[model samples]
Target: MTPAQIIQAIEGMEPAMQRAYLEQVKTVVGAATVAEVERLIADEDEDGLVALLSLGALSVFLELARSVFIAGARFEVKAISIPRDLGRFEFDARQPAAEQWVSAKAEEIRANATIDVRAAVREVMGRRRRAVVWPAAQQVQVSATPMVRTPRQSALDLLGRVSAQTGSRSGGVIGLPGNYAQYVLNARAQLLGGNPDEMRKYLQRKRRDRRFDGIVNRAIKAGTPVAQADVDKIAGRYADRLMKTYAEMLSKAEALESFGAGRDQVYEQLIAQGLDRDSVTKTWRDRGDKKVRHTHSVMGGQEVQKDQPFQSPAGALLRYPGDTSLGAGWSERANCRCSAIYKIRRK
Candidate 1:
């Protein structure tokens, strides 16, 4: 469909459709951003595409951290100042009334799970190549070495890359504003390693820490007659503690915002570089049977029921799953397989 036509389809949908339909449109936008930049910039121009797409690695890390608190967790964004050459991010977060908030949002958390790395990205690109108008008529593909890494490893590597990229002088090709880029980098990095990040591991340990195992081992070592009921009681308390601890580490918005801010640096640069602002349209491309994720059943069910239209962010791209383009969305926005299709027609 033409870019304008796809947008029309998007605007006509109900709010839920508008919100849930635009899945991985960000990834597609990222791909389109790179392609459009290559079209305008010379091959001799230093390649800054890697910096553009690498933000996905940060996105994955933040989402995973937030998921730890998905089930009724709460957090508040607090403003803070830190030195540059660290990363770009200024807002800090605190959860003052977390214990109270968890009681209310349990349903929302249980229903929404962690977004998938591949699927989250696939939706951005959608499944099919969108036929778009360019200076030269042709199809385009974005080759981003999908940034997947072990949790600790990803945290360290992403922080290093972000610091290095943000630390560089601003006037260069991948233009991050000099004064604020470092702040944004540090803010995003801090979210990945926030109290919640560490708390997530601790909460899990509350349920399965080796202390319980040690109880069993010690009983046998001491030649103490350990009753099966007593062992079961100890294990049960671990489960109780795990749940209690999870409730205590309420998730907040700081990390998701930081990740998106990092993404925004690249997207804004590409738009300025020369991708047609009007030509790019948002359309909801269904994940189809091949890409449907079981976790996103609530959202996926709707996409499967009918043809979902795409909703463009106008110029603003979606940062993460819960982020919406307009006044629309669904309970199952997380891990949605649908993509937000963007087409660039040079006018």
Candidate 2:
């Protein structure tokens, strides 16, 4: 399966598993989103609401990110030929230097997850605030104690899961590194899209949440009589919408969070097993925009344009996930679901 397919499969898991997964997230941001709405109704604390939203976003992000990494790892092994048996990655450790590189790179990416997740969390928080002019919580703190795993825990947890994935589901595809190499390419897309993915979802949900808060807060602060129905709408009606939106967003974001930080480990594994500079070629998707960004569109295929998104021997487009390789700044990242395809050439 392509990274895109893997992302879809994970997002479209059994309903029961999906519910179980979300129940975990609700313990953090899900509940907070509701409580903050109530707080706005009761205490008229706009800043507190914003802070809560930010914290809630952080919590959601951490959980989503962890899920993405695990899903990506699982897909990596299975993407190639399914192993005759499941347990023990088919990694060839013949090249000590390559193996070492993979291990070190994985750690490096894992460590960087905290920074990336935090930044994405803040972007969501800030975007939500801007949408409704949600005031600063005289004490806006994004980390009201993350409801889910701490960012670091989430990162480490991803690495652990990837290790488990390798042990349990890889082996047999000797000298065939397309799956491993593709995993890295796909993961970079996942990592790059994380911030925008969550931010878009937050922006949509909070736009409505805060809008409701504004209406109720206005009536309450003005000593205006809020209709009983209005009160109910504020607390219950929109809460349902918030959750529905959240579920949708979770699916979308996780698809993007399908992951990051584990690219190093994946790359090294591929290299140790014989992947090389020419092993993975990064290709662009031609959206066929009459006016497309030079970065991705310049490549010029019916599916890709010409002369953009520089490609290096290392892999597909020189640009990784977070870079503005798309050119319209971060907005391009949000809309560009374009993927990195990995093809292997062997003598």
Question: Candidate 2, residues 1-347: lDDT per residue as tens digits?
Answer: 45456335544642333453344333434333333344342453435433443323333434444455455455555555422333346433334653443344334333433333344333323222332221233114222322222333222111111123333211111111222222222222222122333223323444244665465444434433334344333333333343344444434433442332232234446554455645444444444556444555654332221123445233344343323223323334333434443344443
lDDT of 1: 0.29
Clashes of each: 21, 20
Candidate 2 has its poorest 10 consecutive residues by lDDT at 168-177
Q: Measured by TM-score, how close is model 2 to the native structure?
A: 0.40
Candidate 1 residue runs with Cα over 4 Å from true position: 1-265, 290-320, 324-330, 335-338
For each candidate in turn, the TM-score is 0.23, 0.40
Off by over 4 Å in 2: 1-7, 13-67, 81-228, 231-236, 259-265, 285-330, 333-337
* Residue-wise C-alpha lDDT for candidate 1, range 16-97, written one tens digit per residue: 2222212222232324333343332223221232333222333332344333223112111111112232345322122333
